[model samples]
Target chain A: MSTRTPGTDDGSAPLLTLLPSTPGGAAAPAPERADAARNRRRILDAAARIVAEKGPDAVTMNQVAHASGIGVGTVYRRFGDVSQLLWALLDDRERQFQEAYMSGPPPLGPGAPADERLDAFLDALVDRVAEQRALLLAAHSAAPRARYHSGAYQVMHTHVAMLVSRLRPDADPALLAHLLLAPFSPDLMHHLSVEQALPAERVKAGVRELLALRDRPRPA
Target chain B: MSTRTPGTDDGSAPLLTLLPSTPGGAAAPAPERADAARNRRRILDAAARIVAEKGPDAVTMNQVAHASGIGVGTVYRRFGDVSQLLWALLDDRERQFQEAYMSGPPPLGPGAPADERLDAFLDALVDRVAEQRALLLAAHSAAPRARYHSGAYQVMHTHVAMLVSRLRPDADPALLAHLLLAPFSPDLMHHLSVEQALPAERVKAGVRELLALRDRPRPA
Candidate 1:
């Protein structure tokens, strides 16, 4: 009735893949059905399209269902709730970003110098914050209301910490991680961009210079 | 009848000493009667006592009035509202700290080397954040709700910015101001101490090491 994977779930990757669904629904279904997978994909695609058209606040179950050409119940079945849907969206984004940088191309993913990679990371991060500020705010606000704990931010911080540790073994990774994330801090970014009337590119440039300082050794 | 003096009201230090009496009423006083000055001193002393005991949040107008044995109207007369009272308290503390550093002694004051002053500034700032976390948070929270514009934080930032610019003239003062303030950023500090469980002293050590890197020029 039930079978277990040897070491898959125990690892720290957080199991982005669908688990094998077991009999009596003990595991997940041992594996997702082909049609189930298709429906899940369609729901997510529709949700993203709606969010893109309006904003995260405007994307609703009914809208998603309409866009996916499915019943609202199916959307609910895939995501369980609105908060879960938002988490799924953010998690999907986080995973895609990680994969791209970790294995993608010369500048950001791999094969570039550590300094260049660091600069690219800041630039990409600022751009992402500018484009996704509303969605990011929604995800964080929804965090307090989530049924289950959201480990999405923790995963992203850990990934950044590891990269910083690898790039500069002697530096304090925790501080580095905080500094790396500072540019994307919601209140600060909003205050600087909207309140202070600073251009996004100038803000990114300042962040890039700040990170560049970390690459050098301390002067006497 | 209205009265004026060479050093009164317009643009001199005595402007602070001259307290405006009941606006619409006939002029009741000149040079602020001795009793009013004594009461003002008593109020400031009591305000500090209340803040030290109950924190900035709990130092209510009625409480300060009661503690100083002054009328509630007098408290309101002295400071327009609760936020003004709290800001005055913090401003008093910051003023003392600035005086000590600008001309008081070595290390934190003018006698130390520029690099050592920078190092000491980071250490003192981290320790200040640790000691006055509650006041800092209250002041920051109250800033958004304040009715009157007081350029208090701007003054503090400018002081620190000047110190940083002197230390690193080649660096952007505004960005350096942000970087220097990073360790003291309330969200970052709270996250590091409460969520991350880092010992306060260790975080200060990390900051010291981090700021030490500011002096070195990045390789071309």
Candidate 2:
């Protein structure tokens, strides 16, 4: 792996930060050191491949070390264990996605109207879950109840609740947010996108339709 | 238990019956043996009270035995295990709910417009799940994936799909059915009803609002 930080790298230690006050919105801190960032990258790349080829349960420190051509000692030092390594991998993508919505651009970010932003967020969510179906589903089923407790879920819930509050100030935004997020559950999405072979676009359209009926009856 | 068969009893074995080709409807066969039904009633009544007072996890043969005033040996002989007893409890309610929708009367049954019936069905579902929230949540978390595979889920899916097809012949009834049912997942309902403390009436209203938007836009 290159010892130099990638040009795109801003060096933010996004993963080390726990429980954001604003969840995904205002969370990234200053970047990690160049060598450390590169080591993390090398290790994650190897682990991702192993997860793809063998599955999350099959990933191990030794396998990732052999694949990355990195020292096994360094791998152990970086991730501490296979489970931490897998979470590191999830966190990497999670931060970027959070960044995209929290501050990246209009519609998905802060510049657009609430309804448009909500639509953009749901659309992006379809793609996000689609990107990591197996890994997320396994994680979710392992502790289905923990979905409500996780920092990631809280962040998403906070973000969604904020949007709903803006969209319908008179509505019970907290409950509405949960209702809206229900269809996005990994198990349900697995049934839709994977088992049913629905195109992501159709799922996105269906979600839009589902949300449209939330606060009002259908228009004639 | 009284050995005399009730006049309504038709001598069919309900417990030994397996998966029906059509899920819930047409699955009852004939009425259960009266003495066996009475025994089941006592066992389940005892189990329900224990579940309500403590929780499904707290249920045991001895507690059910003490509450039902039946022998512990009989509880084990009848239900085999706590888990099995809980399922039998669910199935008892499931059969009655199915009967109401399948052959009972107007709106929820046969004589009303499909849309009206759909509305009534969704409303009743809120009540049905709310009735046994703790028991259902325990059973559901134990096998989250199995929700889609269970005979109960299939029966509900079949019923919903039939209604969707009636309401929108050109739409993908099967997929729409799954999408509509996603929110009713026991975990989500628990989060909404128990954790958030939203009342069953509010949940029922919210579901009606949700289904009202099935394929239509919100009324201005």
Task: Report RMSD for candidate 2.
Answer: 8.7
Best by lDDT: 2
lDDT of candidate 1 over A1-220, digit per residue (tens):
0123222222122221222111111122247889988888788888778677766656666667778998887887787655566556655565566666668795777888765676676677766666656666544332221201234444445656666776667778766666456446554555566656777778776664454333344447
Stretches of candidate 2 exceeding 4 Å from the true structure: A1-31, A213-220, B1-32, B211-220
Model 1 docking grade:
incorrect
Docking quality category of candidate 2 according to DockQ thresholds: acceptable
Q: List A-chain TM-scores for all predictions.
A: 0.70, 0.80
Task: Please name the candidate that would achieve the greatest TM-score relative to the true structure.
Answer: 2
TM-score for the first chain in candidate 2 comes to 0.80
**lDDT tens readout by residue for model 2, A72-101:** 889888877665666677777777888888
Instruction: List, residue by residue over B107-142, the lDDT tens digit for candidate 2.
Output: 999999888888888888888888888877877777
Each prediction's number of clashing residue pairs: 7, 2
Query: What residue pairs clash in candidate 2, if any at all?
Result: A11-A31, A12-A31
- Runs of candidate 1 exceeding 4 Å displacement: A1-34, A76-84, A101-117, A138-150, A166-171, A196-201, A211-220, B1-84, B94-121, B138-150, B157-172, B194-201, B211-220
